[model samples]
Target: MRKTEGLLKLLSLCLLAGVLVAGVLFPVVGAAGVASNQASETVDSMSSELATDPPPLVTNVTDSAGNVIATLYKQYRIPTAANQINDAMKWALISTEDRRFYDHKGVDWKGTIRAAISNQTGGDTQGASTLTQQYVKNYLINVVNRENPLGQEKAQEQTIARKLKEARIAIQLETKMPKDQILAGYLNVVEFSHQIYGVGAAAKAYFNTTPDKLTVPQAALLAGMVNNPIMYDPWRKPDNAMHRRNLVIDRMVDNKKLAPADAERLKTEPLGVVEKAPDKPASNCVGAGPENGFFCQYVVDYLLQHGMSEDELFTGGYTIKTTMDQRANDEAKKSAEAQVKKNQPNVANTLSLVKPGKERHEVVALAANRDYGLDKDRGQTTYPLPSGVTNVTGAGSSFKIFTAAAALKQGVAGINSTIQVPNFHISQVFTGGGDQCPPKDRYTRTYCVSNATEGGSGAMSLQTALATSPNTAFVILEEQAGMGPVVEMASKLGLRNSMAGNAATGGPVDPDNENAQFRTSQTAWYGPSDNSPGKGSFTLGVSPVSGLEMANVAATIMSGGVWCPPTPIASITDRDGKPVPYKEPACEQVVDEGLANSLAVGMSKDDMPGGTSHAAAAAARWTRPMIGKTGTTQNNGSAAFVGATPQLAGAAMVFRPDSPNGGLYDRGPGNVVAARGTNGDMFGGKTPARTWFGAVSKILEGQPELPLPPLDPRYDRVGRR
Candidate 1:
């Protein structure tokens, strides 16, 4: 029976060779007909396209000083070169997957013929694909057609067409590349387990090590997983994985790639895999950890907003260099948390820092009391608290700076220009833009403004008004400057984000809806564009605002009146270090240089004895040539402080970040401390200003004290530009 079987196999091989010769020598005698033409065309087209693009690599993000902080990628792969991988990795893979890999051109025709015959005769289906063929197939599915469902299916479908395509591509690949190079490429592209690809990521994921440190057993286990990573995952199915790994080890020994004694010893060893992969580079901003994550998130958002798509950023393998200063971020986080504990609920203390430059304003750091994470229980929140407007309730008289800027721009007021300050007054030019006026109240149906503290009565210079933060004084100045310029000035200075919506209320910023004033859309609460007389209270600062915008506002002022869009990116480059284009920074001289310099000096006394933030600055023993402003909303609900010097600019705010209507004193279920100062009040000069000094003072520690632009005397009084 055995002799007859051997004769039959030999006769079958001869018959197959005869059919192939007849088809090639005499095409018209072929039985395949059009299928032969289609098969030939498929081979030709598939072989034409070789390895065009390399596989995806990890995209790294670094800080301003070039310290890698985070990594973004789709496949979580660490592409290793041929020489970077351990010899055991390549040898184990080739020995187990294709023993004749070194000798064969691309495919083993003998094994292919035997496997095809047995498969056609109802024997078990066998895969006679060589290492080069497997590499071609994996490259097709994972690299070329990774995002194409139909193309991926075509590459993976179990059919003769797929096999032929792989064989053709593999043959072409062999002609262009060496065997070792093909082996390295194959190991770099194939999947080892869920979200784990390449021998580099696999070694780190499975054993908490690198490819260069992989042992014989470690390499064998990873090599075995490429056949079916999901099925042989050591964590999910240790027994099946053990059996598969043992097969690779045994095959290596059979091929003399490993010693018999070593194979036996390795087989007896336990499957050593880490309980879970430390996904350091796999997570997006989450991997950045704690305070650094917020800056990472900002960089991601900034890139998306400018032009880069999410897919391109995560998978394009580009290097992102951000302007985030790690030291500044750390100091800001420490200070903000000291003022408002990270565990403090419903209230958030935030600080934003920007470096002022005549041509560009770079955002250096953003920090908040809340952590940047998903754990709500651990007082973690992902809200861009330090840079956004969503958590702002109001900034009170802090906006007096914009109103003052408008007045200076229009030549209607100067640093020493005196304005009447009344303890309380009903504006003749403005009307109440909300329902705050009670029906029977004395100030009913009118725009009422008052100073938060007494003795703000009588006449005061615009400079003194700024330091004391008297609402009535700014109201009077806003009326003199007219509503239009004051509103536009806020937008130009940096409150543009707030000028798009009404403050404290969700009412849309409707310039046409004159009736919006009756609903908090105008009067003291309207956005910057609402130039109606009803918005005369714009100088009183009742508007939604962004901390980042406010910080840049201070930067704009410090930059000698040049307004530049704050950017978080230092630079971006492709994997090969080619420069990537981004939106060019734009800076405008919105204010006259002389007028802005004088204005900075005018507002410089906010930390003086009579100033609002004097107590806070004095407590820190702060003595620096800086300008600052303090503001508190009505009823002490929320407040903000903005301050800056020639070297650094920053904004700090303490507000109710949880509930829309929740007041600073109204504690929430998660509250450990209410948003209040030691004086039992929510004031910008208190906790908020302290938050600024706590952070900014340290952030500016070693910087040289450059004097602010010399004040032009012409603008000290009511001198026009």
Candidate 2:
């Protein structure tokens, strides 16, 4: 070419020297306004972000014993220390990206001039940016302006201004961070895939190995990806990636880090990446597996419900230590799935547990028959079956305990007080829709109710009534106790979702919901369906309910009547290992400790020979001295059982949520509510009880069997208050 002009010739000479690079170097004379105050600020801000901290690392969800169940990330990154990376990786990067990396001060001026002249002379397109400059570019896109599209576009814009800014920032970074740290950060922050990032994460993801254990070929392949990850992604373009990887090997040989013979030999080696990456980051609860998926979701929802944003959870690099007992969760999951197959579209079995403590109640598990996922055709669902009031979920007679609490509080009936129950009750006192009552009683909506069992309705104490789950007896007692007190007690004892009507959706208020018409607090469970005050079936558990809250109800009783929020996370730590403070509802004494102790004593007969769950308990071979109650809705639409020891409390519930019309508990034949493709013999005393026994027993194994607190004699008689 003829003699180059003023700027071009002068720039060429200075570029080859690599001396006075970005420091003593003169700015481009013709490139006016390229180094504005805004550009200076950009360089300074980016250098500060890098010098202070690296990019965001992955946030992990760990079970009680420290097993990672889930990973949440805006980018799949696991920042490792500079010294931790394999030397092979360092060599591979230095050889391929910048052979004069150590010699240059951030900008490879010689390479830059060569690239410019070659491109102008009809040569192949080439990049001249050194490792530090490349690191600055990636940091801007992935870390500083990760979520800002315009900022990312500006970062990658092909303009002299952009190059000048990057060169300036890279020089600043070289001055601040150690070379090793800069390299390590670049390796950590670089993207390997949309969901795979960092050498630490990418090593494990691609080869199921750690950074320190990476082989030379593996390092070469990864280093090559820095140039064009999209065009050479091994999954999408294995052949292209292989050719680029071999090129990296050749560069290593040229750098004298690898022998020519070895380079040629290694070039013939397979890409050797695993067919698919293992432990690849999956963003949501779906990655936590089928059973722990429910627990994972609970952790996410609980955090989001309590003021945590989705972006913070995914990108804030928090280590979420959940309270879930993995063993208990695994056992509970197996038990629940054993009851109803996951593929049983019409049937769902769910369980949740709360560990009872004086100060806190930790949710140990939230499990269901259905796998927690997004695929609907494969019979998967994200429904909060274990924690929310999904569908019209009624707990049947299990709610008798709530009425019992109210009765004990109001002094209407005590543990030892006797109430005679007939086969059916014609409630002259309370009135609501009574369509399930005998045809003669249905016309008056007189709140008529009957016993589910045959021939055992005689005079019985309150404790015996609970064990037998006598519906008519509880209805009469509820009438005597009053409606508002029973509903209030249920809420106080942990039936929060059932009481709120909208708490299931995580919002406490919805103006368009029935909350507008009903006294907001009483709308869900206590309010009148026909614009009246009393829910005739309140004591019968004839309302939507949450299995987790029900388990908390049992935990409330077990914790000396202290109602605590069923919190899933035990603790949260930030990237620096500093504790992140989180506050949940405080534990409060919702009922007299004496009354709860006495109720525990009264409900202990549930697994005995004469009690409703006796047969199922016997089948489970259970002998733990614990208190429990079973409930079955009319037509067997749903069944549930709440059980507890001094250590822990849990609830199991079964329903056919898929069958909309009835989700009926069709007892084999003669019931129109029979769900499709079911054995149709579901009851609280059957699958619910069996699942409860199977799961809770395993969790309670090896723990000391603490006896229930002594019954307060004041709770032995009627009308104490």
Candidate 3:
């Protein structure tokens, strides 16, 4: 009976040894066999193991039509399975992190035993940690083991404890997870330094490609960096990194993972690190360098803070379908910059907010006096010149846009209501004794037939006042419409971000108070103001208004009252490219269609025989029928054109608000620059109009003709039909 029992024990020992050998030799099928045995034994019944699924990945934004617009990701975690990883990387990981990886059970017993022996002797604390344990540490524990010098790790003694804990976890994980899940966890856990957290990031950071696109040698180099991020950093020490990579190749050959010849050939090849930083998530959209650098930076910063995540914001695979056409913005930026350069040659050197570096130019223009006045040459200087004290220039005639719309909204004016403009002026009282007149009224309130007379004042039709931008005519209309109604109209036109809200409501905005610097300045009602010296300009447009706000204003009239805020990013998708829900623009009609049509009446006048913008108005002008208004401010000589087509409506502005040497700047108020020259004048009529024309031309490309409103039947009664 004793002999028979001994024979059974011997047979069991032999079977166990055979199983171990099989597990070591065939890791793939062996894992399956282990799982099968566990299932048969009902091991899962005792272990309460839970599998973790990753959050839905937001890879990029798409347009309304489902085109990619941006890429988004969280935790910066990218999964790199064995299939997605390079063979070289696999070998490197096995050789350095776990040489006996396949040969072990859920735990590397031999390595643990060896490490235990070494720790007992106080030999340089080498670890016996498996890839599974490292993954747990990185993805689950989130602890940084910074004890050892050779790599980022704890002592062998501590490592053994961690490995034991990991062994228990791995067993539990295997019971609950599929092989792919385990591999994905491993891929996401591995980190390569230099802000790279996974194989995917490493692939992009080093080679400017994705994991699947990586070559064997490239993969090996990346894998080598896992053990010692700094020592194997490709950018910092290419030689050391390459040497480590070669060691990985050598290990692959010794393990029979690669042919000797293949390993040798790979070692001889040069490391192909990309010359430039891989195109990161956010691209430098403006490639023309520091010219217009401030404006570009402002836009980029805004997008970063409010647009999307770093992943979704900068990834190259996604397309950003911005509300503002990139092409149009770029051209506008270029034209404005070129014009600035032509007009003010030496002014480029003035805007210096930062320390000078390679190709870093900080140039901004400024005004000559603290109060509203004509601009003069200030010449360029280094370091960003302090911004001028910007006072709010009263909206002047532009405010009439609000008044006219309000009158219509309140049933106070008809489209053809022929009201007369008389000698008139509006007054606003300050806390101090004196009363101030609007900047436009500062010169005179005159309704003349031509520009030949200044003191002339007369009664002109409302249509004529609107066509010529008469100030008194709008003031009278404002009284009938009431300030409240006009303010409401401006607000609905998407004109927010102003102190005028409070100022027009008779509130005070103290510019002298540093704590209230960002507060809306009273000048916002008219335009940007030098509210305080040593501070930047405030107000809309050439003052403080965003380009998008201007676009919305035009959109409102063109929509016959509908307003759609500009949308830059469209849709978000997962790593696998599945859609994620997002908030779209809230489309609403903020004005009456008929009222909007009345405003368009005056804009359409600009396209008629004697219209202001008639030079560019022709039968073949815009692909769609259109109407628009041109505004110029004398302060900065900035000119603006707000135009709308039935299909598309937009606006454009040109100004050098931060000029140091005011000479060569806009000659009149900022708004008038567009009307200065015919070819490329400083006035809104010429250069600014041209900019509008160019942008409209591009946006209209390949688009069908826009629908138009039915002809007014008033002509039937007039007999002109």
> What is the lDDT of every predicted structure here?
0.78, 0.80, 0.48
User: TM-score: which candidate is best?
Assistant: 1
lDDT of 1 by residue, 165-194 (tens): 576567767877888888888888898777
The regions of model 3 sitting more than 4 angstroms off are: 1-81, 86-88, 103-106, 140-167, 178-181, 208-216, 276-397, 423-457, 498-543, 616-624, 657-682, 701-721
Clash-forming residue pairs, model 1 = 433-517, 503-544, 523-534
Summarize candidate 3's per-residue lDDT along 341-408 as a digit string, tens digits.
42343222111111111111111111110111122343322121112112122222333566667766
Worst 10 contiguous positions by lDDT, candidate 3? 349-358
Candidate 2: Cα lDDT at 498: 60
Candidate 2 local Cα displacement, residue 97, angstroms: 1.9
**After superposition, which runs of candidate 1 have C-alpha atoms over 4 Å from their true positions?**
1-50, 278-280, 433-444, 501-531, 663-681
Across 145-210, the per-residue lDDT of candidate 2 in tens digits comes to 889999999989876557767777787778888888888988988888645778988898888898
Q: What is the Cα-based TM-score of model 1?
A: 0.88
Q: What is the TM-score of each candidate against the true structure?
A: 0.88, 0.88, 0.67
What TM-score would you give candidate 2 relative to the actual structure?
A: 0.88
Number of clashing residue pairs, candidate 2: 2
